[model samples]
Target: MAAVRDSSFERQAPEADAEELARRHLVQPWPYAGSIGSEARGLIGSGDGIYVTDGEGRRLIDGPAGMWCVNAGHRREELAGVMYEQAMRLSYNTPWYTMNEPSAVLAERIAAHAPGDLSHVFFTTGGSSAVESALRFMQFYNNVRGWPEKKLLLSRGGAYHGSTYLSASLNGRPRDRDWMDVADGLVVKLSSPDPFRRPEGMTVEAFADQLVDEFAETVARIGADKIGAFVGEPVQASGGVIVPPPGYLPRIREICRDNDILYVSDEVVTGFGRLGEIFASQDVFGIDPDIITFAKGVTSGYFPLGGMLVSERLLADLRRSNHPDAMYAHGLTYTSHPVGCAVALANLDLLEGGILDHARAVAPYFQERLKTLEELPLVGEVRGVGLMACVECVADRESNDPLKLDYEVGKRIDAHCHSLGLLVRPLIHMCVMSPPLIISRSQIDDMVAILREGISRTMDDLATEGVWQG
Candidate 1:
């Protein structure tokens, strides 16, 4: 393979024709299939640092870090070089019966950064697979231990585990499951631990106590023997970066431990420096989960790699039990691919070198700057920690009443931001931003300036178009 140094994408034809070609060939993810060609979402041609060049030769700041995975930024020669070398040496290998050096090395490095006794690793192709594998492993563990009744999962409302069947069943996002059929009765959901969305007039501390008490009551009602695992994101990402009350995670961990339920942390969006650490469950949140599913930033979007970290105590129990002969019987064809692992290793070097520290030092500034948006009448709340944040738009801030569903407010904000040379990830009525961990303070200012202007323009549009009566 040869390297292409060209930055701008060469136009094959007019922009309209190019977009039409995309709609014809590409089936966008999480999309309304009927509206494939109705809108023009620019094609990303090339990326460098925190910027991506669109198909029409326009450069824009990457606000969501390529779906919250590109933590080390784009076009990193070191990662590219590692991938090229590993592919040339050993592009493919069957992990079913054989193991590779890169995978072993990467797993060791990951375990080193992981918390507590999470000493074992199982790699997957991406976040979804990682989550699927963890759930399967939990089921297998229960089955082997003669507790087949422990098959139900306990996840919170507004959590997103993955898109696979079992994992998707654990997803609590209303829209995500509205049209799809999930494995019924497999999961019992608790209320989301969103402080911003707490019952009106309830204090944050009281809200946290209520959330924990709810979990305790749910366990008592369902019987802990019927539950296999309690899965949750430290900070719910796709459900809109909902940060919980301070003591929420630790209290949940205690309850799970008391009830003999596996506590699984879904770090698909928060791992690998997104939260200024390799893993945030223990270091930042003060609890050691029995299982941790991670993806996205492992290779910094240079390669597809995700994994599940297993605690030593759980494996010890499995080894000592009568199920010593039991087999987990789970893996993927691309599990531990050498190229992905090699790229991940290089990405880790970048993170551990200095980027993690930079993120920690700059996160407060980022949060502080975005909080100013709350002054805008169209903005309801600003909530986040570390590099990730969400700005939710509302029609009434006093009541947090959202705009009408058909208003497409988030899309309008995204469009305006794109015009101003910034790319933001829109989740219905909210804008999500998790820029590259390498982004500078000055770059953050530019990104926030564009976001503010975009929101302002959106407010004007909504008023002019009669979408906002006030």
Candidate 2:
């Protein structure tokens, strides 16, 4: 493992002038329209293992795992090679009338790992398309079943579904929909299962029961025949990594079944070894979703690909029911792209080889290490499962009073962590960590120590500004 100089891929020392070109060209997501040049993170040059080096050659531990998709880590030569080989042989074949080998094989492999009778797959370009396809399939299934009135989609508050119009409408996060025009009557919102934000004097178990009751009551009020599907993220990743209580998912599944509603599990951020499993719905939560949407880690971020696993029973009913010759009539140009599927197949080999087991073994240690940060005065709560975690900062520790929006506590912590050799996800006042699943125990220790120091620095800054009394 000794470092060796390589002439083939020599680094071009980054010039400070690069910012000028970026400012005039690049359009970043979720930022002030005109601030990309001044506010964007500097150019990332390269990555290896669990670390990424920026243009200035600052090698930092990738705590957010490249937006929680690089489960196997960066610079995976096997995945890269697969994409290259597939491109060389056959890159694109319109999936409308024609088909490809890699696509069929990848679908079979995915169905084998999915829960229950989920034996079919519908490919998409990414997480947003996966979600959009699942919703459309639900509508199609109900329409073919003579329940065309069932068009309502139920979603929970604080859920992050996707960016497409239909999928984005299902997103219940306030900030996600504040300025955008969401499909008004298409979605019904429910409260999030955030224990930290639960009503006062309510026990966790009671809160769980209350949530299920509310769901049942809502179904009764809205009439089951009018509901199409209920979509949810098992862990609510982008909503500050909010983990629901035990038994919550199963209960929701039961309610969906009773009401003849399709249960859609959005596993875009939780699948493919991130939660110590191939897919968390069945293995970890003990529930079988009618349709499970997945993306991101399918190819470990090496390719753009995602899809939905459909239950055989549902497809069978649709095939046998009315409108038997009707077409679902929905597909993307890149549907079942040969190159993406080939890369995904190779990525699966790495996960099954040993990376999944490594993640399972190291998860407990990761969770325990993060919990220690709760002792800091600025940290109000530290919660997570597996490799994903969140540290919420507040001004009043006892009452959990969150800081003002302008404070940008999480961004401050992220800035310090970046300087100290780590990069964590910043969500307003909370910092999230979901490191590459292959990160070692020693490297995890380093990550946590840097986060601790980052928070310490932020606390000092806040004290100087007199915004928080520690």
| Model 2 superposed RMSD (Cα) | 2.7
- Over the full model, what C-alpha lDDT does candidate 1 score relative to the true structure? 0.91
Q: Candidate 2's C-alpha lDDT?
A: 0.90
Clashing pairs in 2: none
lDDT of 2 by residue, 1-470 (tens): 11222355434534465555556665677776467544545678889999999878999999999988999899877877777778888989999899999999999999999999999999999999999999999888888888889999999998999999999998877889878888869899999988888887889999999899999999999999999999999999999889998899999999999889999999999999999998999998899999999999998999999999999999999889968887798999999999999999999999999999999999999999999999999898999988899998888876787877335899999999999999989998999999999999999999999999999999899888786778
- Give me the displacement of residue 321 in model 1, in angstroms: 1.9
Whole-model Cα lDDT per candidate? 0.91, 0.90
**Per-residue C-alpha lDDT of model 1 across residues 23-59, encoded as one tens digit per residue:** 6776666777677545456778779999998887789
User: Cα RMSD for candidate 1?
Assistant: 2.2
Model 2 stretches with alpha carbons more than 4 Å out: 1-17, 34-40
- In angstroms, how far off is 170's CA in candidate 1? 1.3
Over 4 Å off, model 1: 1-18, 36-40, 405-407
How well does candidate 1 match the true structure in TM-score terms? 0.96
